[model samples]
Target: MLKMKSTCERCRAALTLSEQAYICSYECTFCPDCTEALSQRCPNCQGDLVLRPPRTRSPTEAPSLGFKAKLEDFLYRA
Candidate 1:
Protein backbone atom coordinates (compact mmCIF):
# COMPACT_ATOMS: atom_id res chain seq x y z
CA MET A 1 0.00 0.00 0.00
CA LEU A 2 1.15 3.51 -0.75
CA LYS A 3 1.99 5.26 2.47
CA MET A 4 0.28 8.64 2.61
CA LYS A 5 3.15 10.62 4.00
CA SER A 6 2.18 13.65 6.04
CA THR A 7 4.92 16.17 5.23
CA CYS A 8 7.22 17.35 2.49
CA GLU A 9 10.66 15.79 2.75
CA ARG A 10 12.37 18.99 1.59
CA CYS A 11 10.43 21.84 3.23
CA ARG A 12 8.61 19.91 5.94
CA ALA A 13 5.31 21.39 4.87
CA ALA A 14 2.15 19.72 6.15
CA LEU A 15 0.53 17.56 3.54
CA THR A 16 -3.03 16.43 3.99
CA LEU A 17 -4.34 13.35 2.26
CA SER A 18 -6.69 15.39 0.08
CA GLU A 19 -4.17 18.07 -0.86
CA GLN A 20 -1.83 18.22 -3.82
CA ALA A 21 1.49 16.45 -3.39
CA TYR A 22 4.22 14.77 -5.37
CA ILE A 23 6.12 11.52 -4.95
CA CYS A 24 8.71 9.31 -6.57
CA SER A 25 8.94 5.55 -6.87
CA TYR A 26 10.57 5.32 -3.46
CA GLU A 27 7.64 7.28 -2.00
CA CYS A 28 9.62 10.39 -1.21
CA THR A 29 6.82 12.89 -0.66
CA PHE A 30 6.82 16.64 -1.21
CA CYS A 31 4.37 19.49 -1.28
CA PRO A 32 3.75 21.42 -4.49
CA ASP A 33 6.09 24.33 -3.73
CA CYS A 34 9.01 22.08 -2.91
CA THR A 35 8.27 19.86 -5.84
CA GLU A 36 8.45 22.82 -8.23
CA ALA A 37 11.60 24.09 -6.58
CA LEU A 38 13.21 20.71 -7.13
CA SER A 39 11.99 20.64 -10.73
CA GLN A 40 9.85 17.56 -10.16
CA ARG A 41 12.81 15.32 -9.47
CA CYS A 42 13.39 13.37 -6.28
CA PRO A 43 16.74 14.53 -4.89
CA ASN A 44 17.33 11.31 -2.96
CA CYS A 45 16.75 8.92 -5.83
CA GLN A 46 17.09 11.26 -8.84
CA GLY A 47 13.84 9.71 -10.04
CA ASP A 48 11.05 11.54 -11.77
CA LEU A 49 8.51 12.86 -9.31
CA VAL A 50 4.88 12.56 -10.29
CA LEU A 51 1.74 14.01 -8.81
CA ARG A 52 0.43 11.89 -5.97
CA PRO A 53 -3.23 11.06 -6.27
CA PRO A 54 -5.39 12.82 -3.73
CA ARG A 55 -7.42 10.51 -1.52
CA THR A 56 -11.12 11.22 -1.47
CA ARG A 57 -11.79 9.31 1.71
CA SER A 58 -9.69 8.09 4.60
CA PRO A 59 -9.20 4.36 5.28
CA THR A 60 -11.29 4.58 8.40
CA GLU A 61 -14.08 6.20 6.44
CA ALA A 62 -14.27 3.42 3.90
CA PRO A 63 -17.47 1.38 3.85
CA SER A 64 -17.14 -1.98 5.50
CA LEU A 65 -19.19 -4.62 7.21
CA GLY A 66 -18.58 -4.13 10.90
CA PHE A 67 -16.40 -6.62 12.81
CA LYS A 68 -19.46 -8.25 14.38
CA ALA A 69 -21.01 -8.80 10.97
CA LYS A 70 -17.81 -10.28 9.59
CA LEU A 71 -17.40 -12.62 12.56
CA GLU A 72 -21.00 -13.82 12.32
CA ASP A 73 -20.57 -14.49 8.62
CA PHE A 74 -17.38 -16.43 9.23
CA LEU A 75 -18.96 -18.51 11.99
CA TYR A 76 -21.92 -19.31 9.80
CA ARG A 77 -19.66 -20.38 6.98
CA ALA A 78 -17.63 -22.57 9.31
Candidate 2:
Protein backbone atom coordinates (compact mmCIF):
# COMPACT_ATOMS: atom_id res chain seq x y z
CA MET A 1 0.00 0.00 0.00
CA LEU A 2 1.16 3.50 -0.73
CA LYS A 3 1.83 5.60 2.30
CA MET A 4 -0.39 8.67 2.27
CA LYS A 5 2.18 11.09 3.50
CA SER A 6 0.63 14.04 5.30
CA THR A 7 2.88 16.69 3.88
CA CYS A 8 5.03 17.42 0.90
CA GLU A 9 8.54 16.39 1.84
CA ARG A 10 10.03 19.32 -0.04
CA CYS A 11 8.01 22.31 1.24
CA ARG A 12 6.10 20.79 4.11
CA ALA A 13 2.77 21.71 2.61
CA ALA A 14 -0.26 19.96 4.05
CA LEU A 15 -1.69 17.19 1.91
CA THR A 16 -5.02 15.70 2.77
CA LEU A 17 -5.93 12.08 2.29
CA SER A 18 -8.18 12.93 -0.63
CA GLU A 19 -5.95 15.55 -2.18
CA GLN A 20 -4.01 14.79 -5.32
CA ALA A 21 -0.36 13.92 -4.80
CA TYR A 22 2.49 12.87 -7.02
CA ILE A 23 5.10 10.24 -6.52
CA CYS A 24 8.01 8.79 -8.36
CA SER A 25 8.72 5.13 -8.83
CA TYR A 26 10.81 5.35 -5.70
CA GLU A 27 7.77 6.66 -3.83
CA CYS A 28 9.29 10.07 -3.30
CA THR A 29 6.14 12.06 -2.63
CA PHE A 30 5.50 15.72 -3.39
CA CYS A 31 2.68 18.14 -3.91
CA PRO A 32 1.75 19.32 -7.37
CA ASP A 33 3.30 22.74 -6.76
CA CYS A 34 6.65 21.33 -5.76
CA THR A 35 6.51 18.81 -8.52
CA GLU A 36 5.97 21.66 -10.99
CA ALA A 37 8.78 23.68 -9.43
CA LEU A 38 10.99 20.67 -9.93
CA SER A 39 9.85 20.56 -13.53
CA GLN A 40 7.50 17.69 -12.82
CA ARG A 41 10.35 15.38 -11.89
CA CYS A 42 11.36 13.57 -8.77
CA PRO A 43 14.40 15.16 -7.18
CA ASN A 44 15.59 11.95 -5.59
CA CYS A 45 15.56 9.86 -8.76
CA GLN A 46 14.41 12.09 -11.63
CA GLY A 47 11.67 9.58 -12.36
CA ASP A 48 8.31 10.38 -13.90
CA LEU A 49 5.71 11.71 -11.51
CA VAL A 50 2.37 9.94 -11.24
CA LEU A 51 -0.82 10.43 -9.26
CA ARG A 52 -0.88 8.84 -5.84
CA PRO A 53 -4.03 6.90 -5.11
CA PRO A 54 -6.56 8.74 -2.98
CA ARG A 55 -7.05 7.25 0.45
CA THR A 56 -10.06 5.03 0.73
CA ARG A 57 -12.92 6.61 2.67
CA SER A 58 -14.44 3.42 3.98
CA PRO A 59 -14.28 3.34 7.77
CA THR A 60 -13.86 -0.44 7.78
CA GLU A 61 -11.08 -0.49 5.25
CA ALA A 62 -7.88 -2.03 6.42
CA PRO A 63 -5.18 0.50 7.22
CA SER A 64 -7.97 2.90 8.00
CA LEU A 65 -7.61 6.57 7.18
CA GLY A 66 -6.66 7.26 10.77
CA PHE A 67 -3.39 8.74 9.60
CA LYS A 68 -5.29 11.78 8.43
CA ALA A 69 -6.55 12.44 11.89
CA LYS A 70 -3.12 12.04 13.37
CA LEU A 71 -1.70 14.37 10.78
CA GLU A 72 -4.31 16.99 11.61
CA ASP A 73 -3.76 16.62 15.33
CA PHE A 74 -0.09 17.30 14.76
CA LEU A 75 0.29 19.17 11.56
CA TYR A 76 4.06 19.54 11.90
CA ARG A 77 4.81 16.26 13.54
CA ALA A 78 7.34 15.35 10.90
Candidate 3:
Protein backbone atom coordinates (compact mmCIF):
# COMPACT_ATOMS: atom_id res chain seq x y z
CA MET A 1 0.00 0.00 0.00
CA LEU A 2 3.03 2.31 0.29
CA LYS A 3 2.97 3.90 -3.13
CA MET A 4 4.01 7.17 -4.71
CA LYS A 5 6.39 8.36 -2.03
CA SER A 6 9.07 8.43 -4.69
CA THR A 7 9.84 12.06 -5.48
CA CYS A 8 12.90 13.53 -3.87
CA GLU A 9 11.91 16.22 -1.39
CA ARG A 10 15.16 18.13 -1.91
CA CYS A 11 15.66 17.97 -5.71
CA ARG A 12 12.34 16.77 -7.11
CA ALA A 13 13.86 13.85 -8.91
CA ALA A 14 11.60 11.16 -10.33
CA LEU A 15 12.44 8.24 -8.14
CA THR A 16 11.01 4.76 -8.60
CA LEU A 17 10.50 1.81 -6.35
CA SER A 18 13.53 0.18 -7.93
CA GLU A 19 15.66 3.26 -7.27
CA GLN A 20 14.90 3.41 -3.56
CA ALA A 21 13.70 6.37 -1.52
CA TYR A 22 14.60 7.28 2.03
CA ILE A 23 11.93 8.54 4.41
CA CYS A 24 11.98 9.92 7.89
CA SER A 25 9.52 9.32 10.71
CA TYR A 26 7.50 12.26 9.54
CA GLU A 27 7.31 10.84 6.04
CA CYS A 28 9.78 13.24 4.49
CA THR A 29 10.89 11.53 1.31
CA PHE A 30 14.18 11.86 -0.56
CA CYS A 31 16.15 10.12 -3.24
CA PRO A 32 19.15 8.02 -2.45
CA ASP A 33 21.62 10.72 -3.53
CA CYS A 34 19.98 13.36 -1.40
CA THR A 35 19.70 10.99 1.53
CA GLU A 36 23.43 10.26 1.36
CA ALA A 37 24.24 13.95 1.17
CA LEU A 38 22.08 14.59 4.19
CA SER A 39 23.72 11.68 5.98
CA GLN A 40 20.41 9.84 6.13
CA ARG A 41 18.84 12.56 8.21
CA CYS A 42 15.65 14.36 7.36
CA PRO A 43 16.28 18.08 7.54
CA ASN A 44 12.64 19.03 7.82
CA CYS A 45 11.89 16.89 10.85
CA GLN A 46 15.46 16.20 11.94
CA GLY A 47 14.81 12.49 12.14
CA ASP A 48 16.74 9.45 10.97
CA LEU A 49 15.95 8.34 7.46
CA VAL A 50 15.44 4.82 6.34
CA LEU A 51 14.55 3.02 3.16
CA ARG A 52 10.84 3.25 2.46
CA PRO A 53 9.22 -0.06 1.86
CA PRO A 54 8.51 -0.62 -1.83
CA ARG A 55 4.83 -0.26 -2.60
CA THR A 56 2.83 -3.32 -3.23
CA ARG A 57 1.14 -3.16 -6.59
CA SER A 58 -2.36 -4.23 -7.38
CA PRO A 59 -2.86 -6.41 -10.43
CA THR A 60 -5.56 -4.19 -11.90
CA GLU A 61 -4.02 -0.81 -11.19
CA ALA A 62 -1.95 1.02 -13.79
CA PRO A 63 1.57 1.50 -12.55
CA SER A 64 1.82 5.18 -13.41
CA LEU A 65 -1.48 6.03 -11.76
CA GLY A 66 -0.47 4.24 -8.64
CA PHE A 67 2.92 5.89 -8.63
CA LYS A 68 1.46 9.37 -8.82
CA ALA A 69 -0.62 8.92 -5.69
CA LYS A 70 1.42 9.83 -2.59
CA LEU A 71 1.13 7.64 0.42
CA GLU A 72 0.01 9.09 3.76
CA ASP A 73 -1.16 5.95 5.51
CA PHE A 74 0.33 2.96 7.24
CA LEU A 75 3.88 4.37 7.05
CA TYR A 76 4.67 5.12 10.66
CA ARG A 77 4.16 2.28 13.06
CA ALA A 78 6.61 0.49 15.28
Candidate 4:
Protein backbone atom coordinates (compact mmCIF):
# COMPACT_ATOMS: atom_id res chain seq x y z
CA MET A 1 0.00 0.00 0.00
CA LEU A 2 1.10 3.55 -0.66
CA LYS A 3 2.08 5.35 2.49
CA MET A 4 -0.47 8.00 3.22
CA LYS A 5 1.69 10.83 4.40
CA SER A 6 0.28 13.61 6.56
CA THR A 7 1.84 16.75 5.13
CA CYS A 8 2.90 18.65 2.04
CA GLU A 9 6.65 18.86 1.57
CA ARG A 10 6.92 22.45 0.41
CA CYS A 11 4.50 24.35 2.65
CA ARG A 12 4.37 21.61 5.27
CA ALA A 13 0.59 21.72 5.18
CA ALA A 14 -1.50 18.75 6.20
CA LEU A 15 -2.60 16.37 3.44
CA THR A 16 -5.83 14.53 4.10
CA LEU A 17 -7.00 11.10 2.95
CA SER A 18 -9.84 12.60 0.95
CA GLU A 19 -7.66 15.13 -0.87
CA GLN A 20 -5.41 14.25 -3.80
CA ALA A 21 -1.68 14.92 -3.52
CA TYR A 22 0.93 15.10 -6.22
CA ILE A 23 3.75 12.61 -5.83
CA CYS A 24 7.06 13.42 -7.39
CA SER A 25 9.65 11.03 -8.82
CA TYR A 26 11.11 10.82 -5.34
CA GLU A 27 7.62 10.12 -4.02
CA CYS A 28 7.35 13.43 -2.23
CA THR A 29 3.70 14.20 -1.76
CA PHE A 30 2.10 17.63 -1.50
CA CYS A 31 -1.42 19.03 -1.25
CA PRO A 32 -3.26 20.43 -4.30
CA ASP A 33 -2.98 23.99 -3.08
CA CYS A 34 0.71 23.58 -2.53
CA THR A 35 1.11 21.88 -5.88
CA GLU A 36 -0.69 24.74 -7.59
CA ALA A 37 1.37 27.28 -5.75
CA LEU A 38 4.41 25.33 -6.80
CA SER A 39 3.27 25.65 -10.41
CA GLN A 40 1.79 22.16 -10.79
CA ARG A 41 5.24 20.76 -10.70
CA CYS A 42 7.42 19.09 -8.15
CA PRO A 43 10.22 21.37 -7.06
CA ASN A 44 12.44 18.36 -6.46
CA CYS A 45 11.73 16.47 -9.67
CA GLN A 46 9.79 19.05 -11.65
CA GLY A 47 7.28 16.28 -12.25
CA ASP A 48 3.52 16.37 -12.60
CA LEU A 49 0.96 15.91 -9.83
CA VAL A 50 -1.29 13.18 -11.06
CA LEU A 51 -4.02 11.60 -8.95
CA ARG A 52 -2.49 8.97 -6.76
CA PRO A 53 -4.54 6.09 -5.43
CA PRO A 54 -5.68 6.45 -1.88
CA ARG A 55 -3.83 4.42 0.68
CA THR A 56 -5.67 1.31 1.71
CA ARG A 57 -6.99 1.42 5.25
CA SER A 58 -8.94 -1.25 7.05
CA PRO A 59 -12.45 -0.45 8.20
CA THR A 60 -11.32 -0.77 11.79
CA GLU A 61 -8.44 1.58 11.12
CA ALA A 62 -9.12 5.21 11.65
CA PRO A 63 -7.31 7.42 9.14
CA SER A 64 -5.50 10.42 10.53
CA LEU A 65 -6.90 13.23 8.42
CA GLY A 66 -4.74 15.98 9.81
CA PHE A 67 -5.74 18.74 7.40
CA LYS A 68 -9.37 17.88 7.91
CA ALA A 69 -8.92 18.06 11.64
CA LYS A 70 -8.67 21.18 13.76
CA LEU A 71 -5.70 23.32 12.65
CA GLU A 72 -3.98 23.17 16.05
CA ASP A 73 -3.17 19.46 15.70
CA PHE A 74 -0.91 19.80 12.66
CA LEU A 75 2.82 20.40 12.59
CA TYR A 76 2.63 22.82 9.67
CA ARG A 77 -1.10 23.16 9.96
CA ALA A 78 -3.06 23.96 6.80
lDDT of 2 by residue, 1-78 (tens): 666778998999998889999998888889999988998888888899888988856334655257776886687675
lDDT by residue (1-78, candidate 1, tens digit) is: 789999999989999999999999999999999999999999999999999998987876876578967997899999
Runs with alpha carbons beyond 4 Å of true place in candidate 3:
1-3, 56-78
CA lDDT, every model vs. true structure: 0.92, 0.83, 0.77, 0.73
Q: Which has the higher lDDT value, candidate number 1 or candidate number 3?
A: 1
Spell out the clash pairs found in candidate 3.
none
Candidate ranking under TM-score, highest first, comes to 1, 2, 3, 4
For model 4, state the Cα shift of residue 51 in Å.
Answer: 1.9
What's the TM-score of every candidate structure?
0.78, 0.68, 0.64, 0.59
lDDT of 4: 0.73
- Which portions of model 1 show Cα errors greater than 4 Å? 65-78
Kindly indicate the candidate among 1 and 2 with the higher lDDT.
1
Better of 1 and 4 by TM-score: 1
Candidate 4 structure quality by residue, lDDT tens digits, 1-78: 466677988888887776678887667888888877888788887788766667555433875565654554664554
- Model 2 CA deviation exceeding 4 Å by range: 58-78
Displacement of residue 33 (Cα, Å) in model 1 is 0.9
Of candidates 4 and 3, the better by TM-score: 3
